[model samples]
Target: MFLYFLTLVLMVMGLYCLIAKKNIVKKIIGIVIMEYSINLFLILIGYKKDGIAPILLKNVSVEELTSRGVDPLPQALVLTSIVIGLGTLALMVAICLRIYEKYKTFDMSKINKLKG
Candidate 1:
């Protein structure tokens, strides 16, 4: 649907940022964007029309719960992915800071240490 297309567009924008940008920070932002788009896509997949929460109540049977509630697996997976992304973002920023301290600039072409 339209949501899926939007998600795809976000993902493409992320990839373009990653490929087209020279700054390490911009690449990190692109990675974060891609991660978010994927999480959004998973969340949308788990959505249901008129769906109840996944929590179980005493009155609800397994069959009724399965039929009435949205899937929890995708939600759980997205949460985990978010945590992982946070850690990754932290590491990336730390690396960028170190690189900036050493190189004094964020531009990819200006750093010549890799030429060896």
Candidate 2:
């Protein structure tokens, strides 16, 4: 509903930041924003109204669990994605730092112009 719309908007914003910004740091931030929005979208997909944890209980029937339980797959997938995203972010930052060490600037345009 509204959440889905917001997620889409957030994704667009992230894309705009990534494409329109010239600062390497800003681009990194944009990548993080996009990653967060994607994670949010995945979480939203697994959401259910009045849903209970996806767990098996002795008293709960299989049909009831199937009907009422929130999906666990999306949650698991999001968790894995988050870990991967973090690793990528770290790698990006490391590369950015190395670039800064070499060029003494975070501006991508300057870096391009100064390349020798």
- Tens-digit lDDT track of model 2 for 1-116: 99999998999999999999999999999999999999999999999999989889898889989999999999999999999999999999999999999999998888765345
Segments in model 1 whose C-alpha atoms lie over 4 Å from true places: 58-64
Q: What local distance difference test score does each model get? A: 0.93, 0.94
Predict model 1's lDDT versus the native: 0.93
Clashing pairs in model 1?
A: none
Q: How close is candidate 2 to the true structure, as a TM-score?
A: 0.91
TM-score of each: 0.89, 0.91
TM-score of 1: 0.89
